[model samples]
Target: MAASIGSLLAEISGVEDPIEELQSLKTALLSIPVSALRDSVSGQRFDVIFSLLDSNEREQVELCVDILERILMALSPVNVVQNYRVELQGGLTHPKETVKILALMQIGRVVEHPDAVTEILNNHDILRGVIHCIGEEMSVAKQAVQSLSKLSHSKPGLDKLFQSDLLNAIKDVMATSDIIRYRIYELLVEISSVSPISLGYCANSSLISQLLSELTGDDILIRATAIEMVTALAHSPHGRQHLSQQGIMDKLSNMIRGAETDPLSSLYLPGLVKFFGNLAIMESPQQVCETYPAFLDKVFEMALDPDPAMIGVALDTLGLLGSTVEGKQILQKTGKKFKAVLLRMSKHGSLGATNLRVRSLDAISQLLTLLPEQQTEDLLALTESWFQLLSNEPMDMIRNIITQPFPELHCSALRIFTAIADQPWGQKLMMSTPGFMEFILDRSTGQTKEAKDGKFQLVGTLAGSSTAAEILGSQHYLRMKTYLREGPYHVTAVATVSTEGAD
Candidate 1:
């Protein structure tokens, strides 16, 4: 932006090939010595270059950001960010997304240095500019969040962003759109994930508490929208403790309980169920269920709903609740009603919506699946009884599911079988089920690659289980082990002895 480059940038409007002219100017600008420009530069020269960056006359945005970055990089050698502080912050509010992105990135560079982080934070214009970028493009908003996060590392920087007038400015922008509000929450959660002190910073911002309040607020839509951020905050140990301490867990539980009678519950019930389900998995499934009986009741209620969207959410939550040893044990406590739900979904063609059916079987399989480390005698018996309750003959029922042409169902069913393949009772069912063992040995079936992998994994689990050798018999056990060693796609090479007089 000094006189030499400033004049070319200024005259570019008169040229027919402005892009080419800008590119050539950028190249020459890069060749000039940084010390020379820093000596001759003033704030007004920066204004000249920034005007070109903000120009609506030419649409060459990449050229503008590139030229600005080159000049900044030259100034960067001596940490002269304050020289063009006004223009760089002003760049954030420019209508173009590229300019906003460059401004956020340059601010990020300052935040990295502890000594200089406050230089950007102490300036009210730069703070406002950063908050203003949240409504811009996703790429730009993401950088803005990153820059804010970098500033949050130290005490003074954290105090300024969280407790100052800029916090109010952020809330005002958050009111602009759904996307922008979520981005602000993302920024808060990102900071909150750092430590309790960082979350305390978020708490001071009021936006964090505001978001949690909306999760139970009278507006059903706000409650639904706020659940996602709550789930995000729950990802950290401190956040979960924070949420639990604030009574949000109980408030959501009460909200869902009342939603059963609310006609508007359909709008938000799925998100609420998803949140508790994730909470159940993240913390203690048994503890969450014991603490909030209504939550699980709503999950099972949603499970059998006529609507696919609600039921899909229900099934996913059930799967998460069944993923751990404790989760599986608690789900087994639900007993007959849940098993009936699984049976209806297992009967393929009627519930032909592929995702719903896939999710159902996946949930059921996970509920019954027992890992070796987790397989106590009590759990083994629990899994075996649930399998039997699924149908008159669980083997035939699963075999039918396996016969379905859908590759996803096929893989999911095989996973179910893999889950039970190790149980002593499960092994006995396979022995007497006629071709069930043959099914394990047969290699000629035409199946998708995923199905083939599923079959191989089934054999692998069977071969690896402790009592398989005794229960499956030595010959069959050795063959399954061989199949495991051979890998999923292994093809047996048949030997052909050459005849003496063939030619």
Candidate 2:
């Protein structure tokens, strides 16, 4: 098998149509043991393959690289690195752009192997060769960036990457085309994630100024990528401090505010919102609100966007913003309108809509705990409508909403039920709906402790009312009593009260 596979590989270089032969060779080679193939004829085949890298025919070079990539993937990385180090390093500097890219891609695969990583990183010439290819065609530059990203996985490799003239090379490529500029930003972001100090190096005022300038650029992708890079930087304290010092918050605010009028702003509004959220992570919410007074309003507008994904992101940001006192105050200023929008979204049945709906309820639940009762009264008033919707909803739909995979939605739904139990009108409406209590009881059976406690509270609240009590009657009341007694301390207290009343 090994000799036959080697024969097929030998035919690849001499075939009239090399691609078909290469495919056949690749399929045949994959079946044989790598050790067997290596022992039998891989050395001679490797020589034949390496010679083709010098060929003028692009197809032949491409096929050779493809075949080499598969062969390298199958063999031991250590052996391949040791045996073919010189040839692989030479391919990195190969004059043909395609050869350079395929070679870098093969190197990327090798870098994934722990043994080859150190070997590749130790070769400074090969490292420099990979970086030099960044100035090549856009496709080649992307491949080079990916290779560097892989190399940066290790501390030593990352250190080597920074010690080189990578930053200067990036700046040089930034002048060439937007595509390469984007790849550079992407590579920097990837490196920063592994070694946050990489962000510190790129956090210079000049580069940040350039990124901030692109935030409002006419090209949508450029603006989005700039926002992405900025967000990535905001992950670390050093990056956040530098970005804040450079006034990124103000630029983000301006873009968000301008999104109301500029049609183009829509393209990058979600990204700008994300950047603002990242900034919020490191900056105080009060500080964030102070910098951008329209922050909540802009985000609330985005929550109401037609795009469900945008709505989900907006809701997530609102959850973050509502965590701080200053943010809650800003949210309260538009509390009624915001709550109304959320309540409307909560009833949407689409999967994306349901997710945002769940998130919106959680956000609203948090806001209710912080805002003044009177300030939240209008928001709370919406609970009757929510109950009305639940009462009228199909049994299966209600079951689905309460038992969906996301426990947050289940918990949020129970919280809404608790809210309904707080109101006289809501209680009256809920008791009037047949199977409502049973549905709550069914939902209560297998919930988390927190959810069970919430259900127990709602049951106790409803059981306290004479009108609801008459509807629950002796049998249902006994069942509620048993459920409560089996619950935690607070629930047992409620259960004790009912049993004493029965006596």
Return the top candidate by lDDT. Answer: 1
Tell me how candidate 1 scores on lDDT: 0.79
User: What TM-score, computed on C-alpha atoms, does each candidate reach?
Assistant: 0.81, 0.61
Global lDDT of each model?
Answer: 0.79, 0.66
Cα deviation at 126, candidate 2, in Å, is 4.0
Best by the TM-score measure:
1
Off by over 4 Å in 1: 1-59, 63-87, 113-118, 175-179, 345-350, 441-449, 491-503
Which residue pairs clash within candidate 1?
none
**Candidate 1 local lDDT, 116-195, one digit each (tens):** 77577678888888888887889998999998888888778788887788888888999998778888988999899889
> Candidate 1 — number of clashing residue pairs?
0
Write one digit per residue (lDDT tens) for candidate 2, span 1-503. 66676677678658666667776776676666666655544454477678767777777777777677667766677777777878878887787876777678777877878977888877777777777777787788789888888877776665676555655655776677787666667777666655445555444414546766887778887888898888887787766776678877777887777777876666687788877776765677766766777776677777777877677778778767765555655555665776655555455432455567677666544443322233355554543443344334533444466677666667776665554454556555566667776877664353577666667776776565444556556777777676666653333223433555564
